[model samples]
Target: MITRDMTALRAVNGGHALLRAYDFIICGGGTAGCVVARRLAEGGKATVLLLEAGGSHHVPAIMDSTQWMWNIGTERDWDFVSEPSVGLNGRTPPMPMGRALGGGSSINGQVWARGHRNDFDSWASLTGDASSSYERVLDIYRRIENWHGRPDPRRGVGGPVDITLPESPIPLVEALIASADGQGIPSADDINTDPMEGDGGCGLPNVLVRNGVERVSMATAYLDPVAPLPNLHVLVGAEVERIGLRGSHVGSVVFRRFGQRYEVEVIREAVLSLGAINTPKVLMLSGIGDPAELASHGIPCHHALRGVGENFQDHILLGGCIWEYETPELPRNNAAEFAFFCKSDASLPTPDLMPVLEECPFASEVTARQFDLPVGPASAWTLAPGLARPKSRGRVRLRGADPALVPAIETNFLSDPDDVRALIRGVEICREIGNDLRLAGFRRREVMPGALRGGDLEMFVRNASGTYFHQSCTARMGRPDDPLAVVDPMLRVLGIEGLRVADASIMPEITSANIMAPVVVIAERAGDFIRQTHGLG
Candidate 1:
């Protein structure tokens, strides 16, 4: 039998030679978890331990920007499946979120749009915290990276994450810009500015790419530097089953490695960055969810908070219109432009209508399953939008106590009549834009079973509209007055001490833009909140 020294693994309850317990234990070293780890470890005051459920982020598929998406369902992704949706004709689609060291940030399209200022301020208003304020969150956003080396006061400079326009080599992106411009859609130089909603922007799609590689991922930006720190440790391929509790405080986490279960104690706090799906599952499994639900599954309840898995919301993206351009050689490498528009053409009192982009297809769609749609020789893309600030909320519940079984995610899309109307409007607008004269030279005709004047278009939409993958709202942050609120304003779990949820799950509402950049910003701010509350140097 292979064995090690017993003393080496033994814990020293109280001793001077003993390494201090981590000031923070971050689970799911993903987009936000990485940022949180880095910010806390920057000054070397707090000990940080980051645990990731997946394997390494150094996979070859992660480096190649175009093929990065291919890594989704492979070992790198959590491969979570949502509950069958009645809204999308009872189809249960797969939600491929990165389960690796860098989490979804490493495998995503790398778009770096920061969404609207109002998105943050709305969150702040809900939480009653100034840090959640738009201006405060904007400061955190600017602190992350240089925005394409420009001297824009709005963009951050000299940060770890490198933000820039997508490099050429993906040419369909460029033609999309030209198409939008020809249609009189206004081009935005800065998509992250306050009140970010606009008609259309000609600027290149901003990305978290650096030196021809994905850089904004937490593994690259945060843990890469402090991983060797004596106080900080990272475990890969570790699946957390539940958090161990004592009275009302989270005492430790029980996880599996190599078919053996191990428990790691946390002296300070345990932060859950397990994304939307797994975060709620962990809470439910740990007896921190609804009492009745736990009792039905033969699991005990630690806290009977009903909001643990409630408030689930994800964007619904519809793939429509294939444009085939007749060119001697396919344009392989060229920069792409972007356009953001209000859902309604009419003006809003304060832009309450959170409709953002119409073209360039990165954040524009979060595909639940990419291969489900039929592909052909001509470049096939989608025109996607979901009601960004959706009024309807869903839930993530447990099928059983088993962590291996994926949680039941009910993404109540188009539950609101207005959201359905918005999708219909989005489809109509995308068709109009695709059929414009500017695209006449580039596109041959619609290849799908749909036509300009047929019911097949409706059939196509019914069959094809898929999940945008921007899942959030479970364990949401809100004031004590709101019954649906899971976490309090301080990012702390209600009725539980020394525990927090610091990823997309805590977002009061999903942002209109791609979530990677915003998730990082959220972690950055959360790091500060943790430090200040704990009085860390």
Candidate 2:
């Protein structure tokens, strides 16, 4: 149901005639898209059309944060698969993404981490835009999030999304943090308290779930709050097929809804918030990618931008680190209640590795697919150590012109030797924490690479590593002089008028933490740019 909020952006579309024109057409009403929609439509100033490819986020199983694992690979997921890589022993990996209104926020682990200061500052430096500086992004974060746990005025208070530190952490988590401390990793009260200062050691996860059960996502926070707005029309189950280009600007966006095709004329502009994977695919499908690549799929090149689908980077973590605790306790929200970041090699600039502390037997996907796992009383905790900022990059290319067909995603995980070495250090750090006396009571023993070291461990990483689901930089926003920049520092498509790209895809580089927070910040700023550009606000 399209919410009818009159005070905010009035969004009421009754027929095809009403859909003929819109001030803004936002594609992919997922994580970042929802934010863009609400902000743009504020005070009934702009008629915004938000098209989500999936249905609403009312699923009880999905809304309940604990049932996140069940949503993966299900209908609610994009279910994109990566190409076979030598790292996984020629086995392709499954890349599950949220397909509904709130996007990944509806089905993710709810860990809302706003990466380190270096993350955003680096983007500001790369794009030569002070608007994306860490200080500006931090203020935007305060506006986007409603801190439920702490009353830190520094962290926004009455914002939309409800973010909180872990609730009633289990004993095992305490032990793990202590163990991490023993390994020279400092203890962090929270990741958001000052990311640069609390950058590493043992840290608590700032989750999106409130009161242990209820979830807070873009739909619940941003969209639903302004549901009564008449200027904001949220069309669910509307998959944008291709963006029709005009002589000098975008003419219309063709989408399919309920088995019927619909084309909405873009009066002002269109924003792509289709995430890292689908964003590039949509660009390529719209004849905006590399000339040769688009031609290969029989897609006529309208605006040949070679960097549209290139420079794809994702955080791939080797889940080979595991442990079976005899009586370990876990959190009510998600198993991964605690975490820490560290530089595997001090010579590296920032922390290149982060170890996620999950209170369960988390083995490789290969093991989980063909093996049995225990839960709660029958289970123990595991340390899933991963590389933080990977140097290896990949791409998503169109397989065909069909909109329903997914693109071929190649993450190229562990392709960089430096990335491999970083993960090695992560594993070594985990081993150090696992054997520390602080967790002696809960540590049963290493479930993977029991006694193996050196080359054997490297081989284990090749077979056990998987994506952290933090994919970014497919439609990277870079310097004007850089030939590979798909979008400018302002997030406007390089050669396309009436079009812009927001979301994780526009990130010049992936953040050092979970990407949800950064996505919100990007959308917040994007909304500002749009309003300022078109004189809406």
Candidate 3:
């Protein structure tokens, strides 16, 4: 039995006061961090410390499923901004990352999309690990999800994360599903299962919501259960500065809490689950990046790993093709309930475009300015077309050595002409679906980008383009021989001892849909590796 005072455990200074050293230190109590902490500490074999930069995830905005978008730009968000991209007509889109306990999972749309099977197979091919194969990853998904829908062997039961389809979907949502079927994208009972393994389909999405009202974030599902364990210590408002090194092995971790600096020794290992941006930023600050880049910031290089922050990738969504509703229907569940995945070109091997039907109006600042959009709570819908597998890649770089300074992110969205072409086709598909005869009873009028063609369509795609908030691949995993591989197949950071990265940052390629499910799988696999290595089982 574990014993720890609950009130004191959450205080900013409580963690350092409790212990100066821990068996394992997990940074960033986000999605992966929470999962890793629970898996490691639940065995009662390791003393784990989970440090989160932001406060708690108990806020209303994080708990309410309908208000998921309300968390963006709030205190819970990291509120990162990208460098101005010429691809978007010199626009610097705001990149919102969750700083709280649940990280992106706390504030995201809660869509439980397990990306296409090809996505995982690609990772298996790159890393030469059968564990990453689609069949194996599917087994992991089945083990983690506590599905609420009808019985299906493909899904699991009695797991930590509760997943369910939208109950009592609005009539407009039903019409949209019908419209998708009319447009050659057939409807399926569930999108998370077989639909993802095939060519393309549409249906109500599985959301990370429990009891139809509460949001089920990784913190709530995983961390909250094991939080009282004596072997587990959770510290909120703890901003990691950098990792201190002893020779080539991790020595200790330094972080700031309530304006006070504290250092804690790491007896076993340190895992970086700080998402893509902060993970690389932390590495560069600790002198574990490219020698030239570290020297440019006046920092001595401890480990000259060239690929600290390269290969940045994010899903780009054009927000979007809008339609006015014939009658008002308030949003339900997570607001965006229905979605479809398809290929931009028939020649493509798998589905590369994923467009979702938002219950409310959705548009980027530039797009909203360019078009006359609905205002003042008018009933409307948006078919936001997204490019799932982008050909273009971006990189994250350091602005300075100070941890307080935000890292410079170059999103480079739509930089490649192929991405622009695919998005143009995607927008066209969205328009067709929005105007399908099956949706005639619900759609009043087409609002934006009506009958546009050629340069105008391409321009629309550029102006409407923005991130889906699925930022990944900054420090990807690959075979050791791969030059750009930052972590090994087992997620161990190359050239660094007692250090591993187990978040979306390790994704070799961004998945073909929302990445929350895939990220959980990554954390699960990382936990298994850690336990197997230390004989924790």
lDDT of each: 0.67, 0.80, 0.88
- Please give, for residues 77-135, the per-residue lDDT of candidate 2 as tens digits: 98988998766678787887899988988888888878887888899999999988878
Give per-residue CA lDDT, model 3, range 120-210, as digits (tens). 9999999999999999998899889999987888889989999999877778878888888888898998887777988889999998877
Looking at model 1, report the run of 10 residues with the lowest lDDT sum. 328-337
Task: State candidate 2's TM-score.
Answer: 0.94
Ordered from best to worst TM-score, the candidate numbers read 3, 2, 1
- Model 1 scores a TM of 0.88
Give the candidate number with the greatest lDDT.
Answer: 3
RMSD of each: 4.7, 3.7, 3.2
Model 2 lDDT at residue 185: 74
Evaluation by lDDT, superior candidate among 2 and 3: 3
- Residues 1-537 of candidate 1 have per-residue lDDT tens digits of 212122223211121122334567888888888888777777777777677778777766775554565686788887877676666667666787887888887787677767676678788888887778877776887788767744677778877877776555344445555665565544455556533634323445576666554345667777777665565666676688888899899888777766666667788888999999889999999999889999989999889888888888776655544443443222221112343444444443223222222222232132324323334322444444344555557898899877777778887655675665566655666556666675566555544333434454443454555566688888899888888788887788999999998888988888766677778877776787788888875
Output the lDDT of residue 449, model 2. Answer: 50
Q: Which ten residues in a row have the lowest lDDT in candidate 3?
A: 1-10
Report how far residue 158 has shifted in candidate 3, in Å: 1.6
